[model samples]
Target: MSIKSTAARAFAAYVDRQTKRWSRRPIKSQHKVFQNLLKVAGNTAFAKAHSFNTIKTHKDFVNQVPVRDYEDLKPYIDRVVAGESDILWPGKPLYFAKTSGTTSGAKYIPLTKDSMPEHIKAARNAILSYIYETGNSNFVDGKMIFLQGSPVLEEQNGIQLGRLSGIVAHYVPDYLQRNRMPSWETNCIEDWETKVEAVIDETLPENMSVISGIPSWLQMYFERIVARTGKKVGEVFPDLSLLIYGGVNFEPYKAKFDALIGRKIDSIELFPASEGFFAYQDKQSEKGMLLLLDAGIFYEFIPADQFHEENPPRLTIGDVEIGVNYVMIISTTAGLWAYNIGDTIAFTSTKPYRVVVTGRIKHYISASGEHVIGKEVEEAMRVTVEKHGFIINEFTVAPQLETPAGELPYHEWFIEMDQRPDEQKIKEFTAALDQEMRQQNSYYDDLIKGKVLQPLKLRVLETGAFQQYMKSIGKLGGQNKLPRLSNDRKIAGFFENI
Candidate 1:
C-alpha cells in the first residue's frame, strides 16, 4: 500500500475511537449539547427573547421557547439578513444557506463558524467509518465526484449566500482537492443538464472510484453516460466501488441503478439538511443511520400524530421509543431554537439512537382517517416489485375524491413504468399494491371492509412522466425530490394533464 493509503487508514481508526467516546454515552452527550447551546447563546437576541437564562430543564425550555417554523422565526432572520450581529447566534453568520420549500420565496439558513466545521467533519467521518470497517482506503487515490450545485455565491448585505451544497464546496480539505472532479468552470454553469454534460466530458476518461449525489439527478448522468459510451456505468468506470446518496429515499431508484451499473456496489445513505447533519449510515450490515448527538445540535421529537395539536409534547432522546414516528425538532449552535425542520422519522434502534426518515410533515395521504406515510408506500413498492419482476421508474399516490355515479373514491397511484405489463398483469400489480397498503395500515383496512373506500387504482403514465413533471416546474435536477404520497392532487394533477 502507498503512504497516503496507510495515512488514511490511520486517520479512520482515530475517528472511530473519537466517535465511540460520545456515541457510547448518548443521553449524556445530548445533555451537554443542551447546556452548551443555552450557555453560549444566552447573550444573543433570540436567546434573550426566549428567556434562555432562566431555563433549567427540558420542561423549562418547552415553556420558555415555543416550537417555530420558518414563517414563525423570520422576524429575527430578517434582522440577520439586514446585517445585524448577535441577532440569532453570537456575531454574524459566516454564510446563509439559501434554500426553498416555504411558500415564502427563498429561505436563508445561517451557517456560523462554529457550526460550519461540523458539516465537514460529519461528512468526512461517514467516509472514514466506511474505510475503517471495510479496509478500503485505496479509493482515495482515484477521482471522487460529488454532483452538486454551483460554487458561485451571492452576497446579501455582508453574509455570503448560496445553496448548502455549493457553500460546502469551498471547504473541502486541501488533500482531496486534487482528486475532486468537474472543473470549477463546469460546476459554475447555471443549467443542470449542461453541467451534467460538462461533467461527463471531464470524468469519462479519469480513474473515478466514488460517485455521490441525489439519486434522481445522478440517474440522468448515468443514462447520458450509457447512451454516449454504449456501455454500463460500472464498465466505463471499473474502479467505482462506492455510491453515496442523500436527499430522497434510494429504494425507488435501485432497480434502475442496478440496470445501469450492471453490478452490485456498496451504498451509503445520509440524513442531512440545511438545518443540520442529523445521521449517517455507519455500518454496511445495519438498517438505519447512526444519529449524531454531539454535533452542536440538540434534538427533540413530537409524536407525529400529535404534531398539529396546539400544545404537543416535545420529547428528548431519552424519551423516544423505537418504531414510533415523530416529527423532528431541533435547536442548534446556529441559533435555531425549538425549530421544526418538517421531517418525520422513526427510530430503528434507540440503543445508540439510529433513525430512518419516514416522510415529511406535510407530505402524506390522509384524505380519510387513514394516514399513509412515505415509508409504508416505499415498503409496499419494494415487496410488490420483488414478487412481480416489473420495473418502476417513479410513482406517487393521491386520493381520488371524485367518483362516477356508483363508485367509491379510492387512492390514485400515478406510476411511470419502465417495463409495460399486460392488462392482466396490471390488475395483479394493482391488487398487490392495495393488499400491501391494507396490511400496513389498519385504518385503511377498516375503511375497505366498511365500504367507505374502494380498492386503490393505478394509472400508468409514459416512461418519462416524473422527469417531465419535474422539468416542467424547473426543478429537474440538483437536490430536488418528489414526495411518495400527498393528501391532495397537486402532483397527481400534473400527471393527469399529461
Candidate 2:
C-alpha cells in the first residue's frame, strides 16, 4: 500500500489511544493499541518495515523486538528513497529531521503528523517546568530565544528536509507559539550559517528574559554579540533571567558562561532527541527528572549492570532505581517500539523520576577492545579539573591509536582552560589524569608495558579557542553538544581551523 495509507493507519491507532485517555481511561490501556495498528497496517508489510516483525502480542513486542541502531536502519532509509512506501508509514513524510546518529553520520529522521506533537510537547514541557521550578513565570515579559537549527526544509517534493528545529516550527502548538522569539517562520527561512550573525544584528529591548540552548553554542553567540556591540551581553540585555541548556555537562562550561554574562545564570538541563524530549531538570540545582511523556511514549530501561552481559535485563520506568545508569529504550507514537537509542542515563530520585543522561553507551574507546564510556571520561575530567583548582572552559578526548611503526596508542587531550595553567602544575595534573584513566581502564597497564598506546598527550590551548572554532563552523546554538570522544581527526581539524 501507499505511505499515506500506512501513516493514516498508524496515526489512527495513536489517535485511538488519545480517544481512550480523553474518556478518562488510563493511557496505559493503549498498550494493545499498537498491536491492533499492526493488523490494520497489514501483518506482512508492517513486519517488513519494522525489522524482524513477527509480533504476536504485547509480550512478544517487549521481548522479541531486537534493538536497532541507526547503522542498521540506513538500508531501509535508502529503500525509502527508492520509492518503497512499505518501510515508511503510509503518507508523505511532512519533513525529515536531519540528525547525527551514533557514527556521526547524518540521518534524515522522518517527522510525520503522528510524530510532531511529541517534539512540541517536549520543548513546551521543558519551558514550563523551568518556569515553575525557578518560580520565574515572567515568560510573557520578554522574548525567549531558542538557539536552534534553521527551520527551512531542504526540499519541497522529496522526503529530504531540514532538522527537527524546522519541523518543530512548522507544527508548533498554537498556545506555545506566542512566547517564541525570532518568529518561527522567519527562523525557517534564515540560513543556519547566517543565523548567529543575524541574531547578533537584530537589536531588541534591554529586557530579554530567558535564553536557552547548548552551552558552547550559546557562548559563541554571547561572544559575537559582545564583539559587534562593544559591550558585554548583560549590558545589551540586562533583564536576562535564566540560561537554560542541555546535551552536555554544564560544570565544565560554567566559568566561561558566567564570565560572559557577568553573573551566575540559572540553568535547566534538557534531554531531547529527534523522536521526542524525554527529560529535563526539574529544579535549579538538581539533575533532570524523567517527566513521563505519558502523552507520547512508553519507556523501558535496560540496567547498566546487566548491559555488559550477552543477555541484559530490561526494566520499565516502574522498575527504575536511583543512581544506576541504564540504557534507555522507548516506544513512541512516532513509529519506534522497544527501540534502544544508545543513551545512558542515571536516576537521582525514583519518587519523582529525576534522572541525568550520563553518557552514550557505545560512544567511547577502550584499551583492550573493552568499551570505555563517556561517564568515565566525564568523571575523570571533573575530578582532575577540580583537583587542579582550575576550571575547565571546554575539553574533548581522542584516542590516538598506535601503528606497527614503533608507536603506542594514547589519548590526545584538547583542553581549553579558564586561564593559562602553569607548566609544572599542568604536568602534575596530566600525571594525575593518566593515573585516573589507568585505574578506570585496564589498557593503561598495557600502555605502561609498551604493549598498547603511549602516555596521553595534553594539549592546552587558550581559553576561548574552542568557542571560536565552534562558531567558525556555524554551530552557534544551545543544541550543539560538544563531541566527547573524537575517534578520528575531525575534532583535531576543528582545533587546527582555530
Candidate 3:
C-alpha cells in the first residue's frame, strides 16, 4: 500500500476507536457532553437567565430551559449580531451560519471556536468511519470535489456570515487540501451556475475519487459534466467510489444519479445543519444514521404528534424510542439551549441510537386534518417516479384550499419533470402517488376514505419554473431546497402565476 493510503487507514482507525468508545455508552457520553456544555457556558447571560448553574440533572435542565425555535432566540441573536458578547456563548462567535427555512426569513446561527470543531470533527469522522467500516482508504489518495457554497464569507457586525459549507470550505485540513478541487477563487464565485462550470473545468481531468454535496446540486454538476464530456461519470472519474450527500432525501435522486454515474457507488448520509453536525452514516450495513452521541451537543426529542402542545414530553437520548417521529431539540456548545432545529426525525435503533430525518415540522401539509410530512410526500413521489419510469427534477406540494364552492380541498403537487409524460400517464401517476400517501399516512387515508378530502393533484411545471422560483427567492442552489410540503398555498400560488 502507498504511504498516503497507510496514513489514511491509521487516521480512520483512530476515529473508529473513538466512535466505538462513545457508542459503547451513549447515555453516559451524552450526559457528560451536556454537563460540559453547561459548565462551560454557565456564566453566559442566556445560561444564567435559564438557571444553568442551579441545574443538576437532565430533568432539571429540561424543566429550567424551555424548548425554543429560532424566532424565540432571535432577540439574543440580534444582540450578538449587533456586537454583543457573552449573550449566548461565552464570547463572540467566530462566525454565523446563515440559514433560512420554509417559515422563517434569514436566520444567523452562531458558530464559536468551541462549537466549530464539532462540525469539523463530525465531517471528518463521517469519511473516516466510512473508510474504517468498508476498508476503503484509497479515496483519500485521490481528489475530492465538494460542490459546496462559495468560500467567500461576508462580514456582518464584525462577525463572518456564510453558508455552513462555505465556512467548512475555509477549514479543509492540510492533507486533504492537496486533493481538494476547485480553487478558492473558483469557489468564491457567488453565482452557482458559474461556479459549477468552473468546478467542472478544474476537476474533470483530476483523479477524483469522492464527490460530496446536496443531491440536487450534485445532480446539476453531474449533468453538466455529462454534457461537457460526452461520457458517463464513471468514465470521467474512473476512481470515483464514494458519494457523500446531505440536506435532502437521496432516495428520490438515486435513480437519476445511478444513471448519471453509470454505476452504483457507495454513499454516506449526514444530518448536518447550521445548529450542529448531529448524525452520520456510521456503518454501511446500518439503515439510519448513528446519532453522534458524544458530539458537544445535548439532544432532546419532542414527539412529533405532541410538538404543538404547550409542554410536550421531552425525551433524552436514553428515552427516545424507535419508530416514533420526534422534533429534535438541541442544546449546543455554541450556547443554544434546547433550541428546536425544525427538522423531524424518527429513531430506527436504540442500543447505540440511530435516526432517520423524517421531515421538517413547518414543511407539512395539514389543511384539512390530514397531516402529511416531507417523508410521506417524498415516498409518494418515489413510488410515482418508480412506477412512471420518469424523474422528477424538483417538486413541491401545497394544499389547494380555495377550490370551487362544491369541491373538497386537496393536496396539489407542482413537479418539474425531466421528461413530460402524457396526460394518461400523469393521471395514473397521481393515483399511484395518492395511494402511496394513503398507505404512509393513516390520517390522510382516513380523510380520503371518508370523502372529506379529494384525491391529490399534480401540475407539471414549465421547464425552468422551479429554477425561476428558486432564483426569485434568492435560494437557487448550494443547500437551498424547495420546501416539499407547505400547509398553505403560498408556494402553490407562486407556481400557479408562473
The best candidate by TM-score is: 1
Estimate every model's Cα lDDT from 0 to 1. Answer: 0.91, 0.65, 0.88
lDDT of 2 at 427: 92
TM-score of each: 0.98, 0.78, 0.96
What total of clashing residue pairs does each candidate reach? 0, 15, 0
Q: State, as a TM-score between 0 and 1, how close model 2 is to the true structure.
A: 0.78
lDDT string for model 3 (388-465, tens) is: 788777789888878799999888888886678889998888898999999999999999889889999989988778
Q: Clashing residue pairs, candidate 1? A: none
Q: Which model is ahead, 2 or 3, in terms of lDDT?
A: 3
* Candidate 3 least-lDDT 10 residues: 98-107
Instruction: Give the candidate order by descending lDDT.
Output: 1, 3, 2
lDDT for each residue of candidate 2 in 1-498, tens digit (9 for 90 to 100)? 544334434544554344334224223333444544455334334366554356675556656566666665556556655555645455545567777553646666656666677666656555565554454555445667777777766774566577776556666655435556666554654554476766655535435767877777677788778777787787788878777787777766666676678776676777777766777665676656555535456667788657778767767655778878789886655555566777888888755566877787766666445356677777777777667777677788877664457776678888886577789988998988877777765655455665556667888987677767666765544255667775566676677555
The top-ranked prediction according to lDDT is 1
Q: Per-residue lDDT tens digits of candidate 1, residues 292-324?
A: 999999999999999999999999999999999
Q: Which segments of model 3 are wrong by more than 4 Å?
A: 101-105
